[model samples]
Target: MTHSSVPAPSPDQESLFAAAAADYARYRPGVPEAAVRLLADVLRGRPDPVLLDLGTGTGQVPLALRHAVPGLAHIEAVDVSRQMLDRARDALAPVLGRCTLTLVHAAADEYRPPAPQPGEVVRQPDLITCCRSYHWMPGPAVLAMADRVAAPGAAVAIMGDGSLWSHDSEWTRALRELIQAYLGSERRAGTHATYTEPRRSYQEDLATSAFTDVSEYRYPVARTWTPAAVVGYLRSTSFAHPDLFQERHEAFEAEARQLLDTYTRDALQEEAVFTVLLARRPGTAS
Candidate 1:
């Protein structure tokens, strides 16, 4: 696999994700049921196949896909967080014995294809998936790696940036204010309250891998939560300011609670809807 030209997230940012792992699993919503259905369509008719899930945070994508593809024989779920891996292991225990569920603890960029021994040809995976975690790696690196790790006709799916919500939503406005106040100028430039733009080249970048018949899908789904749930969800984000300052953390929590109550009519509700991009490698035996 060719190394990605895109740089990984900063060590401090990565640490934030690691610290937020538990909260993320507790409050972070799973993949949408509709997106899972789309993945089922992408993997339909494939024989007992092997799958590699890049950036398999807490194994949500694998869990969702396994539900759709019950006949899958093997799945390798990789992530960088030990805490996240532990949660994934616990969540996937029921199917662990049935299917080969290998939980690899490593950053996606650093992961390498298994070395072949004498007289042994490594088995390339039939399907490769990058769920919400693709943004962490450089796009060029991922495409190059996919070319090397996936079989000739393998299917690769990149699903993320599907978050589409009302920019005018009160919660959105409050969160923006809170981010600006708490993060100051350090907040990512051009970042909006909603997931609007594509973070990377979707079709063109993946096409560089020489995959044929590329396609994309967008699915919309929503989840509602109360004020407390909103707080929990906010704590799950990598940009969460809670851990940075103890006193300020308490103050932020109080402010968030009040803002949520005011905006959500004392209920504090928000929803997230996203699109899933589904693509395939050329020469797939149909």
Candidate 2:
């Protein structure tokens, strides 16, 4: 299992994510109940502990975890996008007083602990978690940053890079045909048939690293969306060629509508399952 380096989001990609913020908030899948339960289990005895959520886009993971673990007090939600941070703030407004929502506008690579004044020392978090955003940073850099910001015995949990949908039984054949027909040979050869093993490779890299007590878990989740919702999701994609092929984009949407019509007549239901990886820093004694 070889983990490919996570690439930084391009300017265009950032624009797409920012533009699709509403859809992302509405249609973006939630963290699986199983994954949320695992996170709660990890933080079971720690009350009012400080937890940092990296790449906290629209604050989905933290919100989900907050629901699962009511005892959690402080969550520093960090993301590079101001628009994303704004949306997250709006979403978590009700609980903003109970929980400290610090929205940091900085890239993952350049993020740093707030500088200590005089003789003061910066405090590391008890737990640091990232969901669906770990793939946005290079693995080595993220690991190093995690090591620096997490206190001894703190946990670093990540869940995503699971977007490859070609593995699912229902869409595999159809997606393959669509890719072949729409994407030319140059791009077609680079695509993966499934996302499972590639995601596992990333987990294996973390598990084998010096980070102690590393573990992995897989959870399944499904969502039902109308064709309009599906189109919204597609619009959010970094690979979507909307500007390059305006006419083709319309055609592809029409084809997708037809496909959805054939499948469900009323609405399209897509099921996605993801693997979650949890790793903890060594205890102080170690």
Model 2 per-residue lDDT tens digits across residues 34-127: 8888888777787566677887878887788777777776677777666787888888767655766566665565566665469954557777
What lDDT is obtained when candidate 1 is compared to the true structure? 0.67
What 10-residue stretch in candidate 2 is worst by lDDT? 187-196
Candidate 1 lDDT score at position 254: 85
TM-score of each prediction: 0.83, 0.79
Residue 47 deviation, candidate 1, in Å? 2.4
For candidate 2, the TM-score is 0.79
Go through the candidates in order and give the C-alpha RMSD of each one to the true structure.
4.9, 6.1
lDDT of 1 by residue, 234-274 (tens): 67664553664356878888887887777665444444546
Give the CA lDDT, 0 to 100, for residue 48 in model 1. Answer: 68
